[model samples]
Target chain A: MTASPPQTGGPWRATGTVAALVVGGLGLALLGLLLGRADVSVLGAPLVLGLVWAALTRPTEPGEVVVEGAHQDPDSARVRASVRLEPPAGSELALLRVGSPSHRTVDVAVAAPRSRTVGVSVSGVRTGRQRFFSVVHRETSVGQVVGTAAIRAGPVTLTVLPRTRPLGHLPLPPRLQGLTGSHDSRRVGDGGDLHDIAPFTPGDRLRRIDWRVTLRESGRGARPGSLTDLHVRRSLATADAVVTLVLDSRDDIGRDISTWSGYAELHPEEATSLDIAREAAASIAKAYLEAGDRVGVVDLGHHHRPLRPAGGRRHLLRVMHTLATATPSGRARPVVRPPQVPSGALLIVFSTFLDDQASGLAATWCRHGHRVLAVDVLPPLDRGRATTGERNVYRVVDIARADRLWELERAGVETVAWHELAGDERTLAIGLAARARQRSRPR
Target chain B: MSVADRARRASASARVALFAERLVATARIWSPSKSRPLPRVVADIGPWVPVWLVTAVTAGVAVASAAIVTRGTVPWAIVLATIAITVAQPDGPGAGIFAVTIGVLLVASGTEPFAWPLYVLLATVHLVVVLSALTSGLPRRARFELALLVAPGRRFLAVQAVAQPLALLGAVVTGAGVTLPWLPVAAGLGLVVLAWRLDVRVGDDGDG
Candidate 1:
């Protein structure tokens, strides 16, 4: 830290050392006169000459300090900011300080009398909105005789959407809706899967009749004569599944519970429960949408309008965006009522399950005849620094959460730990998805 | 603008405000909340170490030079006190303390005008004067571009070139029983005018 920045922008001024030298030189001259010593008075001669030189050589204008071109690759963790520095003519060097992702600071210095744009990179960033490049800069003269005011420019920010990951085929609602889709339903109609072969009656399509089966049945002689009782192949109807993702964003706690009281700060790099929840929700929504299923989202915290169910790539983007913006409400209001879901839509809830409220909502959604899958999005606890009392508190909370998860399982709402992995080295969500596909398959 | 345009602008402004708030929401409590005063030194990174080194070296050189010139307890006390003062408040008027003390001590010692030690003492004095002038009023953490020293260096050499020989000439002329107090004053004025006339602009020619 070289100089304290002034609150307001001001013109250049001489440094304190210049004033000190001037006063010291003058005092020596006086002392020399008092003592009648020529050498003593002349001892400070170089100082006076140096001051005169510095005075005449000071920079005339405040140079430019501009910062622009902030870039962050979606697939990469680094954020780069480009800064343009033009220290005025007499300036020896210019210094720039910039704030990076997760609120870390970086500094860079460049020799002045030149205009240059320098790029600084910051790494280890996660998905979210952040102030990428806030810069403070100034130019100082040689000997720092005089310098311009320290100026602040730009705290440029950008929002990086939550990333989507691939998942196995997910579970569907008990009943599928819509006429045109990739998935087959229980309702009998024209589809890819043959439902059964039965004796044809009036209104049966003639093309669906199987002559080979009719002849075989006639040989058995149960009820079929030659072409007397035609057999027609029937297939299931094509319909799309509708899934609603319920995100409990009321409390964004981390593995370290010490910061729950808001006194100790939780750094940005530390992944919070909400961050995990968003990634999980986005992955599920993408999977469902890609499978020709309509997916929607509900923020249990903000009882605001939940996203309506829809299909296609555009709706998938909309779901991801909504998931990205889901943030912790940071307050407690009793969940007077759970956010509403589409009738017969599958509910895959993402939550920490810290309290019974979120689990209770999943149970309630299950009771409504929707196939509910409650995802426990809590991160692993860091018990290394926990005190005896803190561990006890955490133990009590864990017991209650574990019971809530157990109750969810008993309620026939599938439960999976989002942070856990299965034998295949995939997230437990993939296991949940595989189980869902098995249950939806024709028995 | 149309009413729809005005609405759109308002919505955009609100969105920007919300985005800024979200960016600082969790961050403000950590590094972004309380103002972390940027030590306005223009280095690429933290310059506290380098600045501390320069200040320490300069202060040591200044004290040593003051001791050599004065060789008196009172001068030594005053010069030593400036070091303490620079630490407590670098922007204070402590830098000239040493130079003034040395000059007074030299006169009391009655040293020869052409003494070699005095010339050596003068060299240290120029260094202190230039460095102290650059660093005294600045923050202790101030980082300087090394090239910034070149101008002061050149100025030091230029002043010494004229002042040293002129001092010898004064001693010679005084031995001949002739006194001229106005000679140093005239020479200083001449140098200043000459420097201004030359008016070298470094930024225009080579890459800054």
Candidate 2:
């Protein structure tokens, strides 16, 4: 990042106070001499002496201030700005102001010869690019500000990444592809989970044989069985599942519908529906990736940036970074063609469901034989303080939205409200059961 | 008590309670803690320049009126105008003009010593004018940062405090009809220079 040149003018000139004191003192002294009033001259002496001393000692060289830690963690990023002067012995005062109108300004003061670093702690309230620092320095005294220089440290940008929450075990897709992973594949292989026991074949190893079952079979009730009647324990094969996250970032509305009108331009400090979607998507991606599943993200808002399904901790970080930069753009509409999904991948669509586009897309994915789960990211409404007319209007809207969700369910798409799933463990169990039933049904 | 009497007493108590609540509400509305509605007259004054100008005029008028009332002279009008100008523009030249005007007014009034309170008030007005003009052009954020620098600023104020008293003492001596010799004045000037040099040396050492 290139630093902008310092802005210097106006206040950089000698302050009016200094000029007034110096001229006033000399003028009074001359007048006193003319009038033969020794007391008046005596009174002017101090002003003269003070201004002279201040002028002789004023700082001349321009100082440099460099602001560090411009990029900070969204949760707790502390920015420190340090200033250095060419002649450090000057008895001038330095002042630092950091932040823009979107955030509260932080003020710091440092005395010359012992100027300390100024630190500002920022809370990750608003995300995206923001101005971090703007500094101004002044060489001032008690009576006058002698010189001033504004550090034009160009626009300092700070990007705040979205905060992630920890999600527990998530249901995976029915189809498993990778050779080595954590999920049970139901095929016999060398694994810990027992699948079944069968008669020993020619290729079966000695360690696989169940000796107790073999011995019982050999000594059958007063009759000796043949040595050929042996059995072996078989273990199920495990493979990795594929999960693709679809994010609908068309509109981010908070719980309060009244603020939704202007919310697009000026988002409230509270996490909006989009923020919830980002956090939820990030958590789900982390959980599945850690479980040895391939996770990918498709931005419904910007189709140009799509992350293909891949598995690893590094891939999880990439998905999170992409989610942090996800912003609501363009008009809300259903995808013309369903996004390419890995065959039989569990498609999780995170959206507010204010419009039918996200629901339609989820239904489309379900039709393509993908296990599509629609997460309703809208916050619960509170109509207790609303007027009768407002309540009636909202009630009508709610009924219409409920019918849309019902239609999605009828289309074999499992719809889950984000708040219900977040608060209740039972809701996740129900979702898991629904996924199981859908997977068991013949296609 | 009869039912009717009890009911009437209850209604009266309710009325008293209602009255008290209304009184408290009115007090809150008029309280200083609540921001006063800005007058429409000042709604369009965007910058602090006009505010500082008004302040300077007010302080100048107060000082000039006090000087006139104490000295009983009309020539103080020049001093008042000069002070107003100085307050409005608080530059070196304006301050010089104001000082000259004050000196000429005193001389014209025949050195009949003004009250010490009046002199102190004049000094305060001058200080206010100078400080206001100096800070008039600063942005609101910069002003806040400058306020944070007050601790270090006290050092400069301390030096001024030490220097100004000596001037005051000299004035007191002269006013008491004492013919102050040049040697002590020279010595005082020398002492001021010495103190300034010592301060500079200390600052240099601190930096090192």
Candidate 3:
């Protein structure tokens, strides 16, 4: 991100005011020399000195810089910023510029005198990625004198990404025309070759009963050239299944309602979006444990790390650790490759589908033979399409999303488009489940 | 630049900037009410005290010195009376001023030169104490204390500078009666204020 220019013009100008006072004093002293009877040039010296004193004594203006950002976990999200006396320090007081619910200002002083970086914490908002644009500082030095300026404008947007959830239900392809032994049911069917069996019971049929058995028991000769009849049970062998979840949090959601302060928190510093994702992934793992499915996550936002597919509780913890501290790579932070789909498992992608790269990645996963499930997260109100141009952009995004949805459908994968979840989780979830089953039908 | 040179420059610049900002902020953040309280009559005594005790002590010394004195009821009497009253009263510039004013008045009214010289010496000592307190090395507190002596006439100057022409309109109704003794009262008030500053419990004295 490009750094903002530093602000100037504060108590620095006190010297000018003092210089004016000095000039006045010098003028007075010259008058004293011209008019007084005794030689008074020496008196003028003191007067000149006083002028210098005033000029030198003028107060300095305040210097300040503001830094705002947001963070999220699977459970919640936070947006916050703080202003401080910029480096090459000259002021102590820092102000917070929070937009909306009436612009609120909070004053902060560094306990370590001129501290440049101060930690800010916002809890109990939501569990998702949050972003802040800029920070402003109003600094004062001499008296109530003030100098207003922008300290830092973050071109690199910060993101608090949504956390992941592990596999809840892992299903096997019941019937496939190509595959034979493993997935297909063998109970009372006529597909695979069989072995020997035991004697007949009440439910056994007499057809051929192995006419040899009847003949042997009744001293009858062999009726036909076949073996005795019997029923057998078939058990199919288990196979590995890989399910990938790609989460894209590229849309700007926190626009109109950016931050809310003083929300009572049970744990003052609650988990952010990444934290929630970690826990969610772990919970999903627990759900999949008995179902016998392995899980993995794809981080589509800007991050220090790359795509990670893990299994068991240990893997979930690893994902959680990354989510807790992942910062959006602003434009400069390198582009990340979406995680590759593992063989045999379904790919379930969770993303807002606003950014082209993210949407493109989802489509790529589907084409690669992965059972892709692209979960489209509705962008927040601020990120909502506004101008005709933006609406058009949204239209393009919607069309792209629709195309991907169809692409996944053609690829025999499920696709779920959802709003902010808590409001209508049940219907949307049930619909997604139904779609999952429908997509599972044999082609 | 070399690492050492860069580091040195960074450190020094940081120091200069911090020092400059502190001085500027200190100069502006001044409060006077939080300053010493003096010049008021009720200020001298603490709560729940007897008024007669104060009067008796002040009057007793005046009477004693008047009755037995080589220099008669002039400077000696006032000097003796001052010492006695100052000790009986609270410790402050006001008490000192009260003692000296009474002593000087007696001297000017015909006390011996020797007796009056003592009063002059005491007055000079009082002035020195006040000046020293002002330049007491504490930035904010020192400046405020210094204002008492240097700008003693600040209020008077303000009125004359801004209100004299305005005062004429009130003359018809209030007469010249208002401005008469006010100058002396203000000066007296200034002295009383000096007293209050001395009364302040600065170090670990714990006395108000």
- Comparing 1 with 3 on TM-score, the higher-scoring candidate is 1
| Predicted complexes: DockQ each | 0.20, 0.14, 0.02
Candidate 3 Cα deviation (angstroms), residue A373:
2.8
Flag clash pairs in model 1: A1-B39, A2-B142, A16-B137, A95-B42, A107-B44, A108-B43, A108-B44, A109-B43, A109-B44, A113-B208
Which model is ahead, 1 or 2, in terms of lDDT? 1
- The TM-scores, one per candidate, come to 0.70, 0.69, 0.36
Model 1 per-residue lDDT tens digits across residues A410-434:
8989987777644433454467766
Candidate 2: give its CA RMSD in angstroms: 10.8
lDDT accuracy of residue B20 in candidate 2 = 75
Q: Which order, best to worst by TM-score?
A: 1, 2, 3
Write the residue-wise lDDT of candidate 1 on B82-164 in tens digits: 66665445554566776776676665566666455455566676677666655543445444434444455556768877666
How well does candidate 2 score on lDDT at residue B79?
A: 63
Clashing pairs in 2: A4-A154, A6-A152, A19-B92, A20-B92
- Residue A107 lDDT in model 3? 25
